[model samples]
Target chain A: MGSSSAPWKQLLLSSIEANSHLKHHSYFQLATVSSNNRPSNRTVVFRGFQDDGDKILINTDTRTRKINDLKHCPFTEICWYFMESWEQFRISGVVDVIDGTTPDPLKLEQREKSWFASSLRSRVQYVGASPGLPAVASEQSSQSPSLDPSIGPVAAFCLLLFDPHQVDYLNLKSNERLVFTSIASDSGKKLWTSQKVNP
Target chain B: MGSSSAPWKQLLLSSIEANSHLKHHSYFQLATVSSNNRPSNRTVVFRGFQDDGDKILINTDTRTRKINDLKHCPFTEICWYFMESWEQFRISGVVDVIDGTTPDPLKLEQREKSWFASSLRSRVQYVGASPGLPAVASEQSSQSPSLDPSIGPVAAFCLLLFDPHQVDYLNLKSNERLVFTSIASDSGKKLWTSQKVNP
Candidate 1:
């Protein structure tokens, strides 16, 4: 319950680094609500961070159903469980979409550099039809648009710029449990104010 | 891509069974949208099934925010990732809360049996203050209501009776990823209409 004293962001970054060093191959479960109000979740790999590490960056194809979900409702949440430390981090907030049509030069530059640096296999996902589309009957990721070396990043490649208003960090790494919330302050400076929460 | 031939229900049951035999600590990430339309998620153990394996069952304390979220929206979603098999299942639907106020005699009986069958350590969670409430500054799961043996089933224990209308099952264990959608028909017979979809 003394989670307030701990630097929440620093702890989170260290947890991620530790998990990666342990070869956890971990992923976060990203949740979004549909226009009809139903909740949907899927696994997403952590790509990077933005906005002074206040925003999380995740890649997706523009044509996916999740992209549509975000369009309808910007409020989303992500949950990450650190296997090595038995810790869990939950972030809830809104997102800004960065795509080919994005106006910001800095974001556009980041996208270009990241795209060129990614492996060709990873870029294949951006080559074909959007994720939720009709597929021909066959074996092997029939609808993954296929892995073709000739494929390059298409206009569908986009990034989700998550702006978190609340962060719930829970650690059960010991006999005791610690739960805390880092919320955006009313000060409007986007500073995170951390407090102890009941575990 | 040949997911069309296999019966939807059969495949799901087999996948669950396979995970159990493989000693996979498989859990589902349950998501519920708050009144403000923000989606939140946490991990829940795959407890059991109701409605003859159609409706999924999960246990929780009445004081959790998720219960309030369900009361506000009723619509929820769960994502289960099978580690060894590299398969994922997403279920989205409404939920029926089973507690002292439930009208169904069968469900009440099920809750009583499940509670008594659970271990003392598990039952201790039901003894605590509402999940979001402040806790006494102390050690060991502070407001986890304490680990006193005298604690019994308080008014907090409840069952989440999930009525899934959409089931999206994907298998990435092999080179080919199989994506299938099983939607409940409008005929009211609970018949699942299955189809192959783009992965």
Candidate 2:
């Protein structure tokens, strides 16, 4: 929403660009608090940003347990490690779940866009049996579910917008750490501030 | 504590063995709830297991914020991803902090053992300025702190014993997932059970 890019966003974008060669660099760990207050962590793929803002985009299946976890507690943290650069970014944010059940039209359109953005192979998984269930004998084989990509997002396809308020960036190679925090401004917009700290 | 190794432990050991070539294979993300009930996560090195038990060992500096988070909420989750094997393990457990103030002699011995097990280079960081603090001009240089390894753990060194009660193992290549849970037995022992689930 600001004219200039946030300092943390610039650093994060540079880190991502530096490690673009590694295929697995797109994967990061997401931590969420369950209803019982227990923490749950899992690996999730980075889909990109939301509307050129600090909101991080992610795609998930509606049937996954993390979806329920988000419902109970929207606060989450993303721990992304760039092996090549030896850097780690721990982004803490609130997740806005944009699923088929969402009431907002713009959010639903974003969900549809994200659904089509995914590769066909990745999209087919949403149509299969729900995650964490006992594998059905017939669906055990390497079979792809027939689906028309033009039909837009299926019911199970979901999108997550992680609106980050704090980012803890640590570069192991340089032994430097910086924390970026977003503060609500007078105009209802967020302002970012960064401080250098010992790693 | 049992005659046979737990199923999840065996699977995790196999994954570690398979990815031993990767230098970062020992690194994993630890997520803990802060005092404010927000989730915070960061990467930590996996020291080893505790005395052939399921308790995972990790060393950290007491000056780090994670130490305070663990104090507020002992429950944490360890998310480990083996890139080569494309396997992920999510371990949820309660952390038992073995710091300098702990009273038990056996736990203090374990903490001391963990201290000696860490490399000299790793141990020196604890003796320096606290993490996430403004870097002092004097300590900003490449000077190494002088310390005798024989002296054992410093006051800043802390040991965390993650006693996992549940593990979620996912193999991307095989499209399979398994949930391992530990239940308390009649004799005050823990028994593990594994169930196959969809990825």
Scored by lDDT, the top model is 2
lDDT (tens digit, per residue) of candidate 2 on B1-199: 4456677888889999999987688999999998898889999999989998889999998888888899899999999999889999999989998899999999999999998888888988989888988877777875867788799889999999999999999999988899998899898788988888888
In order, candidate lDDTs are 0.71, 0.89
Highest-TM-score candidate: 2
After superposing all C-alphas onto the true structure, candidate 1 shows an RMSD in angstroms of: 4.4
* Docking quality category of candidate 1 according to DockQ thresholds: medium
- Total clashing pairs for each candidate: 2, 0
State each model's TM-score restricted to chain B: 0.80, 0.96
Q: What is candidate 2's lDDT per residue for A1-199, written digit by digit as tens? A: 4555666888888999998987688999999998888788999999998877888999999899899899999999999998889999999999999999899999999998888889988988888888998777787775767777677898898999999899999999978888888898898778888888888
Interface RMSD of each: 2.2, 1.0
Against the hidden reference, what TM-scores do the models get? 0.85, 0.96
In candidate 2, residue B27 scores what lDDT? 93
Candidate 2 Cα outliers beyond 4 Å, as residue runs: A1-3, A141-143, B1-3
In candidate 1, the second chain superimposes onto the true chain B with a TM-score of: 0.80
